[model samples]
Target: MMTSAKREAAPANGRRLILFGAFDRHNFGDLLLARCAAAGARTDIVFTGLAARDLRKFGGFHTLALADAIAAFGSEDADFVHVGGELLTTTAWEAAVMLQSPSDTARIVALHDRSPDARTAWARSVLGTTRRIPYIVAQDDLPTRWRTHFRAVGGVAFDTLPGAERNEILRALRTATTLSVRDRTTFDALRHAGVDTDLLPDPAAATPALFGATIGQRGQGGEIAALRSRMRSWAAVQLAAEWGDDATLDRVAGSLLATSAASGTGIVLYRAGLAPWHDDLDTLRRLADRLGAQRPVAILESAHVLDIFALLAEACAYVGTSLHGWIVAHAFKVPARCLVRGPADKAARYTDTWCDVPRQWRTPEDGPLFPETISG
Candidate 1:
């Protein structure tokens, strides 16, 4: 460790900071939240997210769904519950307030979403951790992003060894490896504290098994395409029926491994939420035939939870409908082209989250990419 500050160690237990946000959607911020909130103990990721994959590699220390979360933690026993990220809608705020494991959970809601104003006092009052840790981690980058609409007011910069501040941190965090800033000052401080851990790539794979990436790539486009192409040649592609779950994706994947000679181009046409839309099996067959036409696709059902990330990462190029496919494809830097039900649908939230990553050339085709309704 040689360059900057210390990693934000998850605070001691009983001092757990429960964060509630829209983690189910697979958006960048959601992924970032899922990846970041597990820094300290007693930490639980309460999400309304669509993903059911292993988040530990992506920093999911302790995760629970909102429906199953109430029993997991109540509002009367903890020191505080810090509101995480820029989520301040009525439901999000309400959920954030209720996530406290203690009834006396002091709400230290960060002003990251919008600064606390007199008008929002009621919402702020509902928080449980403010009294214990009123201080907000409003980093330098945030001020520039929110100079006018909101204010940090009395907050600190977000440079608390930010996982995504630089490549090393991102890679380490992404892989779930122990990471300290790569500078002498930071390393010496931790070493003196008797905390030494070997560094390994975060278990979350960066390069897809079928892609061209020999290195780190997250937000870059060309890198993803190359990676996907690489997977197309090396890894097994599970062409799941667009409506089947992850389990079907696995079976289809198994079929590829079993039937096809290992040319590294096995694809499964897995289906997720799309199964219900088709009225009959024949219609689904027709649709799947068309959807799976351009590339080599085989009909498979949606997959189970555990295999989604690995299965997607194993592929170099993912041409599909599900948001998870797009995300896993993009995370490994595999070139992903989505045929989302709606152009700017909620499913697009994940892709859209990282949509701004690659610097795309301006063209008539690009106009649709930039949603006009959001161009305020």
Candidate 2:
């Protein structure tokens, strides 16, 4: 490990680095990405939609204005710019926002997502405007769509390794300045693609300070404190509306009630989605009302992500239709089991280590043995 003097001296003479990402939301997972970015930034301004009330949970930002930073871009003073660890499938507003004002001398760097399908067409278009790109978390044997996109964008080289099997992917890695990957799938893929693999964990996992702070704040007694403190073995439940299966929701509710009843602990249900698809609240409300007569259930209708996370921290275990709920529980070291209804790939990709249900936890003949699995 480097000495304190070396660490302190590292950024003393380097140019200011401007970091950017889709941090303008109330999602805890997104905040985890922002926290990772914050941990590395020497001096930075964050452009996030996170309310001032919740921004305090992740400290160390120089400026926390959403509008000014989004509007002005950068001050043309930084040496390099980096956007880390977010799926860029939507419109390229952020890339447009950041590149709008660029320092004449800044070298742009990016942390690429692991999946080939994660980046969208608009993202490729916006990133294409940059000079030769330097990639982070760069994968070998990228899907043709991404490979074509990178080639069109005048891509220079990759710095990080991810696995690939396609000769094209291996050929691409041969040009990377440095290389590493985080998953065995990627490792074998890259080895097949003919590139050396050095496994590393996802960048977001490296920053525990923010996650710790979130738990610390939750520990402080307040509006939810009474409920949080009263609950010791409650399990967290969350689901999305896009699934559109009322029967499934009912089953989940019944499972939660059974869990609560059997374990002798309250049940905390979270409405974890945001607008256009913020179906969790209404769905959870209906389920809570139905389960209330049978068992004590606490329905969290809060729109703030931290409040939900704080509540999750109090749970003994978590079972959820929302992937992030399981992730948050796992982050807190609480046992988590995912209730997957739709695509199993995403769940399989991320939750290989967690207890997971390839399908809904409950089936026609099943009482959803989830309570026993979760409480156990």
RMSD of each: 16.1, 10.9
lDDT of each: 0.34, 0.46
- TM-score of each model, in listed order: 0.35, 0.60
On lDDT, the leading prediction is 2
Candidate 2: C-alpha RMSD to true structure equals 10.9
Candidate 2 weakest lDDT stretch, 10 residues: 147-156
Candidate 2 residue 224 Cα shift, in angstroms, is 2.6
Tell me how many clashing residue pairs each candidate has: 73, 6
Across residues 1-376, which tens digit of lDDT does each residue of candidate 1 receive?
Answer: 3343233343344432434444433222234434433333342334422112234443233445432444454442322222223221123233343333322333334442355353146434543222112212122211122111111010111123333332332222222212322222223333443434222222122224423342233313333344444344423232223334444333333433433333335354433321122112333355444434333544433232223444455554555444445545666666555534443332343333335553211222332221111100
Task: Please write out the lDDT profile of model 2 over residues 206-316, one tens digit for every residue.
Answer: 333456676567557554676656565577777666544677666666667767778777777776544333344667777677686676567765646557667767677
Give every collision pair in model 2. 24-49, 141-169, 161-180, 163-186, 164-189, 164-190
